[model samples]
Target: MDQLAAMATFVRAVDAGSLSAAARAIPSSLTSVSRQISALELHFGTRLLLRTTRQLALTEDGRIFYERARSVLGEMKEIEEALAGNRREPSGRLRVSAPALMGRLLIAPLLGDFLRTFPSLSVDLLLVDRNVDLIEEDVHLALRVGRVADSQLVMRKLGEVQMIHCASPDYLARRGEPQTPSDLAQHDCLVFSDAPGVATWRFGRDAGSGQRVRISGRLWVNSLDALATAADSGTGIVRVPSWQVERQLAEGRLRRLLREHEPAPAPLHALYQPSRLGSAKIRAFVDFLVERWRGSDPLGR
Candidate 1:
């Protein structure tokens, strides 16, 4: 089988939604398109697509193969363009990793527009809560939330997310609002982290490296949404990233607190392996993110 040609036909057929559509797009006979796809399935010893008279759907194996093949083809096109000295429009596959909740809430929504801006570019986004090794995960780029201590990879600063101090009006009504970080010591505080210990909330200070006060609460939740819900129900004061609780603050489900003592916002960064240093697609995406956050106030500042 002509492997590359077969893969190309398979991809086109999938994209065009039918063998006849693929045939028209490839400017080839329907028989030839059909033959190529069959060759691919035979070569792989697996059925790539389940076809009905009206539509096509990929099998589990087929979807995986499609993504890999698309990435491979995209890279080949980029290599050909570079060899021919074509104008660089930032083409090819970009594998990006980001934290799960943050990625969905922030990064994923911007991707449709990003892809529209650079049509030749394809993204493979991996959303996982844990930090991914760029080289191990085969990621070309990553959007990381919070403080980054990974000095090994190339990093770009992409602004920050504010830590919003908030509580319910009823909570304050029952237990008076804390005026300062130190005052939080006397009130119930809902800790967002997973461990049981003295929880620390920081406050920005004019003359020093800010203030840290230890507080204890009746409830602590690992999930951000759950933490917000607990705070909304007047459980206790919760400090969370502004992005997660912004809706509650806006709708008055949760009321902001300690504006004067708000801690310095946690930073966001784009990280990539050293091998990806010269990649145009990675550069374009990072620049796009930096611009997207510039003076846009995602932190609800």
Candidate 2:
């Protein structure tokens, strides 16, 4: 048996979850795929798969080998691409994740141009507000808006996202505007329900000293867009990323509040696993984003 070919076949079978699925993926007969896996197991002197009529499970050793096989196969592909002088032409499905609001407002709009630039490539963009594990989720890249707390992942700073507190003109007219961060206690502040005390807004200097205000409100919603909408409709003061409230602020629907005490701007970054650097697709996509946001003041600062 060709050992490397068998290893590649085994990795494909593991990813496909079934011999039949693997055969279909490779456009080969089921017998051929099964034979490859059998040869691979025989070569290793261990059963890699616990096969049943309805399911396939990995044995303990199979799991370890599978991980190594994947890494090896990926490196081999990268080496081949580099040797073939195809490193500049990235081709494959690229999976990217980003915060919901930022993805919808900014990244989503750029997908068209990016795809047009690289017709050989495809993108799967996941937009979610919560943090995602890049390795576990199999994401090639992620756009994060806050501090990157993970030490395991590699990060490249793309831009800064400044947070802002805003209220609708009508609401400010009725309830009066807050003159200080300390005065937020007396006003209705919309916040996320998931974040118990998100209404407790913080403001500080770049030097690290900051003050936190415990705020409460009549509207407690989970969606940032919803909070911005409620604020635009005169519900209450809503603190959010500046980009989210840019249109409202420009249209005079919402007014920026407490500019003298806004918190330090959070950094935006493109995060990925170190292993992803081997993929030309990931490198190209990240480079495109970095160029787009670099000096554009993405935070609307």
lDDT of 1 by residue, 40-148 (tens): 8898899999998777999999999898787666556545644544356888778899877678887898899999999999999898867886644557788787667
> Which stretches in model 2 have alpha-carbon errors above 4 Å?
1-7, 14-48, 52-87, 193-199, 294-296
TM-scores for all predictions: 0.66, 0.82
How well does candidate 2 score on lDDT at residue 204? 77
Mind giving the per-residue lDDT tens digits that candidate 2 earns over 1-301?
9878888888888888888888899878989988988888888899999987655899998998888787677656655654545436888778899988889988998899999999999999999878886755667789887778897887887888888899998999999999999888888889866756445667975636798877777788878989998998898999889988787788999999999999988888888776555567877888888787667756675
lDDT of 2 at 44: 88
Give lDDT per model, in order. 0.81, 0.82
Worst 10 contiguous positions by lDDT, candidate 1: 77-86
Model 1 misplaced stretches (Cα beyond 4 Å): 1-86, 205-208
